[model samples]
Target chain A: MTTDALALPMAVPAAGLPARVRIHEVGARDGLQNEKATVPTEVKAEFVRRLADAGLTTIEATSFVRPEWVPQLADAERLYPLVAGLPVALPVLVPNERGLDRALRLGARRVAVFASATESFAKANLNRTVDEALAMFEPVVARAKAEGVHVRGYLSMCFGDPWEGPVPLPRVVRVCRALLDQGCDELSLGDTIGVATPGHVTALLAALEEAGVPVSALGVHFHDTYGQALANTLAALQHGVTTVDASAGGLGGCPYAKSATGNLATEDLVWMLRGLGIDTGVDLGRLVATSVWMAERLGRPSPSRTVRALAPTVASPASHKEQ
Target chain B: MTTDALALPMAVPAAGLPARVRIHEVGARDGLQNEKATVPTEVKAEFVRRLADAGLTTIEATSFVRPEWVPQLADAERLYPLVAGLPVALPVLVPNERGLDRALRLGARRVAVFASATESFAKANLNRTVDEALAMFEPVVARAKAEGVHVRGYLSMCFGDPWEGPVPLPRVVRVCRALLDQGCDELSLGDTIGVATPGHVTALLAALEEAGVPVSALGVHFHDTYGQALANTLAALQHGVTTVDASAGGLGGCPYAKSATGNLATEDLVWMLRGLGIDTGVDLGRLVATSVWMAERLGRPSPSRTVRALAPTVASPASHKEQ
Candidate 1:
């Protein structure tokens, strides 16, 4: 990208400053986990390799959750070893010490912890309250730190909860701080149901900054259920957050969350960032193409409007016709 | 709307400030024009009434174009007189002197002339080149002015043309200037294909201002084709343009522009504006309900994501059921 293209002429506000955003592709883990059919282990690993080959530095490999709870990702244990040390840090979703232990044994060096800011989401999703879930992660965080494994904390339902109404900003800030204090290197604030607007993101981020939280240590996960993900990410980027979690081709929606749609597509996010001259270092065309390929494997077209409109050749007409 | 809420604390450079923003609700005209099934004139009048009731003070109530071009709005002549002296000013879309004469005969005090920024879109859509189309509108605008009718000019394909990649900014500015000099009360820049971004909106508005076009006389018409409509609208709002063009439930798309989604939804725009504390005088629930009612008439769901997600008792179970 040209320096001239990146430079914003005249003085703009600091809160509105364009960010150099990096998208962490999470299709294999967070995306496919909610799929109706169980994706094969090789297919998951191949998806990871394709994302890695497309210049993605971080590809969430798989979740180590129990098979009974999430049958879709039951092959996590079998998939990890095959993708070890493939020029990218494969972060696996781990619920507790046991999951982390299993991931560590598979040669994993990065792990992500899942928690919810709302009590109802935590109970429905993990069968625990917010405090109970956090307590379970305390030991896992220490163990990961001792093993030299980086930890990332995902705080879901940070904006609005289905059972309850608008989530309090203070609660989100408190959970985020607790996760950071527990030794997680980065905290991703998730709008799991996609109810957030740019103003909500701005207010939440501003509240975080006001509470003395370092904005640079933040990441964002957004759902496109309400079609506000990309705009919300722009708001997050303006607040200086670097890492963003996205699903390839906008894959993945919370099956349990009736109002949920897909996560923000990596291609759409990359396209927006590139237009703003933000260096994401990912190949747009290749990333879009990979989503097209994944769409074929799942027997569906890619959910991302950008991928569908921009790259229509990932799967043959016959393959699409099979569905 | 509180003063504090409207303060866009997000940083934006001074040079990036957009010249102006205008909103034109096309629910009655362009939105209803493309419906395959005939919409009752009473329904169209009530639709316009509900839109104006929700603080949409400027509405495109009907079109005087040839019935062959748009049979859905063929009742424009009868509909115009029935809805006269509404709380808001009604703008009727006129294609040529004949349509302008029809509108004037029906007591239309405000009329809009449609032209394109590209030769290809102009020829394909209006059956004339850019210059020839403007020439057609020149006499119409003069006749409308003689009849004391306020004339608005619509410049389609302002950002990127479908046949021509990345429309030159100068070409856009020239069309805009010509419309202004030809006595257009305001100019609506249209991303008819929905391929524009916030950067493109900002650049185009800036270029227009640099070309000495009055910012207050500028409005925006965007399609959600790429899901950038709201963000692009925000960029325009930040530039101080107050008038924006939206369809109830994002209701319209150019039939010639294949794959183009609906226009920015009136419900979604009102939602975002309300969240930003921008007083649009639009009622979210009423706007959503009206669109949902209209969608049923069309045998489809409303295209607005906000309406789909936020409105209760409006979605058909089969609306999103995968084929």
Candidate 2:
């Protein structure tokens, strides 16, 4: 690479932000799940390894959903053991007790459960009411805690819902409180449709804090549908959120939402974090290279502005291959 | 368009931000100047008219640089007359006294002179030393002000430069003060390389404030090359900047910098501003339609994430044409 190709942002620290941020990389699981084509099991394994090698400490490996439900992640049983020995944290998604049981049998130490703040998504995604979905997750969280596995609860539609217009702050707070009450270690507040603005993010964080949920246990998962993810992430960081969920190369869109875009790109987030003088322990060049490779494999360019700008030659051509 | 295609962000106001912002639209001038294909004069005129109809108060029409220098906008004389009847502020760029004379002859009321923060960009872009470029702009600003015309000074490379790395705060302050001292009414700080982060944005704004430059007279022009523009714009807004410069469809990339990307998309900026309950008087649907129309003329998909997510059916197919 030329010196120009590897140009990094100059460090200039902002006040009222954490000194270091922990990025929960979700490309292998949340990202690939939404792809039209199912990737091979080994490619998924190698993707996780590359993310870890790029200095990401927490990588969500794959979902333990029933193979028929989400066929893309059906190889969870086969995929978990391939990278179980990596030094980084690999959190797999577990839909219920069955999913958790399958994950634990493969020696997975970290797991996440998906929940919804809106009732419509709960019914559609889980085939159960919001309360019933929580009840289904009750035993999964308990069992994961009992086995000393770290658990993360993903609360979707925290900002807006398609069927329901704007979700009330109190309604979202209730779901977040319930997840915490169920012994989940961390909560990732998701903007499933990417309709969130900075003020909305700050308001939600404040509401959660008032409900006695500490900022330390909260992470933000934003999509870029309206191009508000990075701005919203900035608001969350200023509100003391240190754990950010991002997908390498901005990999996936919400499978349920019609207008949803991909998750906040990891490389985009890293560029901002590095510029703020916040240490993410990520090597951006390696991360961009990895995203380029993944985009080539996916036969489409990464939907990441940072990835495209940094690796223009490789990224621009991938779009041609899509034709 | 279906109601789903017209999905708008729910308004939630943030604390300490201006109630309304003035968007200085630059797609006609700064945006198209970098395009390899020369957009027809009538098409450029229509883009401006559509922007005005969409509630943009200020639209940059075109530059008055030597025709040979910017062949894409070589028909500036023919273009200005076509859009001059629009009831909006059309600020055209004037490089020096000669360019200023041409704009004045065309009855241009508002004109902007380009200045650079670093010595390298000063030499590369203007082919003059930093002071020499300022010397050339001094007469143009005085002449325009003396004729009761509005003058804006564009200071490029405010954050970082390609030839020289991170630009120092004092150097930027010096050039800004020079432009203001030369009778320029407003200053647009350009992050030409898109390497700026929020802290750096806040720091620069604070420094400019300390140098007796009010936030009211300052505008921010950010590129999304590194995906930092919106986050940085949020920082500037928090620091009380009320004017922002954006292209209609994330239209232009820096011709001087190899790794640069387009300016922040006006649609992306409007999405965040509207979501924050900050009014720009812009109709998002009309704006998206306008960008979509322009992107078709350019024969490329807009770099704006909001445009792609909202107009997926129209935008996704444009890539096939590239092949």
Candidate 3:
């Protein structure tokens, strides 16, 4: 580039950065669901409580899917009552009519449905085609909306699919629009295989707008499998995405994606947002503590860099970004 | 942000991304220096050869500091003449006039000098004050320049110092200008503790330009301690930087910065740059293979995410971005 071009204002100006961002904590549901060990119901309860206490206003408490499908989260029925009283919007994942029935019976105030932007992922994850899966979620979202329950829609493999190398932009936009059209309040675009770069993110967000989806109604869920999650998040934020989905402690990647690793860690995201002078409301120190405690239950150290840098044994803790 | 704001172009337009980036491979020098085990002279020679074969044109071969200071690169004289015939720039680190004398006797074509942005880091790292260290290097740079050898200057802890919280911008800018004014061809700003985010990088680059330092003479060396390396690199590239410093397989972090982990992996950088259509002329497959091979020699798996996802054990390598 010419020296003159470098002097021009950067495309991602500080003014384009979001002032306040809402983090949707998905560790309780998405993170624990992928773990080999069945996290104790009390442990799950405490995780949600800690997440809410750490200032995560939208905490996905549990998934109401069947025990046969994901046995790890089979205790959702017992876990829901534990965190239902917290001063947070606890959204539980509801897969079908059966999952929605379970949530409605438990007086779930908020629920989320997962849709696939790729055909193979829909078949492998939902045992149905993409259209059939969306058709199945329509009534669940409509009924939940009728009962005064808010709904969120997650479109998996938005950027790249495990089966399809790169999901077409129109495929993601179609699924996102269908979810929002069917009464879902917000849609999160997921890069299931974690193959997205910033350019793909910006272009996809632009295409979603071209499809008539409002920017405020869209959030981004990126996996750190390729180390692009935070960078992609910055790109999305630059393009006006105010809501972001993060797993506390970099908890979960899609179990169905097989090769995908952890989600973007909330601590890592909070660190960047704080440095950018954006408000995330969540306390970073408290968030790292929560992840460290959860990692102990799994008998492993947290994979989060922020958590690693701030852990008790880390010297010069006073100089760390968290401190 | 409003829906209308989303319609606006992203801050980093695709056209603004760099078309070609130079990869300054630092694995042989910086990577092995931090390693606990001493690599043999022959192994270091083979490593440099493989890096050049993988299309890295500028590979930092070794450090010419006192043997007692860094025993890892103690065979600099033997190692230099070994790969001196390769089609690459082998720039060894010359700490002072004594080191410059050693390089001059050995017919070194390119050399680099180190400076510190903070006084605490200077004393801690170089056992000298910032000005003292610069004064010590001015002669080395002048001697190297007199011999028609290209010199590159490195300013460490430019963003955040472990002892000092955040190094002031002017402090970094002043050191940077001093280095460039002393006849160094390029200045590589080093985030020794790696706490910088994209916003800080943007502001610093802008500040440097305002202080009359052209972006053409700048390169960036970021550590992945906080997982912001790739994001910060994107911000730098958007600001028109065509040169980046990365270690193969994410090899090294400062041994002094207890919290810092791996250097930004060249494979990871290539993955993102390739996705953004930026060319760095490095064969990522060969690079990952080289890293995996080096990891075997070091008796550990690489810390790079791209390497982990593209390793032989990974199930779905076909859909991987690296492949």
Q: Pick the candidate with the highest TM-score.
A: 2
Residues B222-289 of candidate 1: C-alpha lDDT, one tens digit per residue: 88766677777877776667788999988877787565668888877765665555666666666676
B-chain TM-scores per prediction: 0.89, 0.95, 0.92
**Native contact fraction per model:** 0.11, 0.53, 0.31
Candidate 2: tens digits of C-alpha lDDT, residues B1-323:
12163367788898999999999999988899988877888889888988998899999999999998899988989999998898999999999999999999999999999999999889888899999999999889999999999999999999988888889999999999999999999999999999899999999999999999988999999999888899999999999999999998899988888778889999999999998999899987778878888988899888898887777544444443321
Q: Candidate 2 — what's its lDDT?
A: 0.90
Ranking according to lDDT, highest score first: 2, 3, 1
lDDT of 3 by residue, A147-179 (tens): 999999999988776655666788888888889
What TM-score, computed on C-alpha atoms, does each candidate reach? Answer: 0.88, 0.96, 0.93
Candidate with best lDDT: 2
Which of candidates 1 and 2 is the stronger one according to DockQ? 2
CA lDDT of each prediction against the hidden true structure? 0.78, 0.90, 0.83
Clashing pairs for model 3 are: A11-B11, A12-B11
Evaluate candidate 1 and give its CAPRI docking class based on DockQ.
Answer: incorrect
Task: State the lDDT of candidate 2 residue by residue for A94-197, as single tens digits.
Answer: 99988998999999999999999989899889999999999999999999999999999999999889788778999999999999999999999999989899
Residue B67, candidate 1: C-alpha displacement in angstroms: 2.2
Predicted candidate 1, C-alpha RMSD: 6.1
- Cα DockQ of the candidate 1 complex: 0.22
The TM-score, computed over Cα atoms with residue i paired to residue i, of candidate 3 is: 0.93
Instruction: Provide DockQ values for all models, in the order shown.
Output: 0.22, 0.49, 0.25
Model 3 fnat value: 0.31
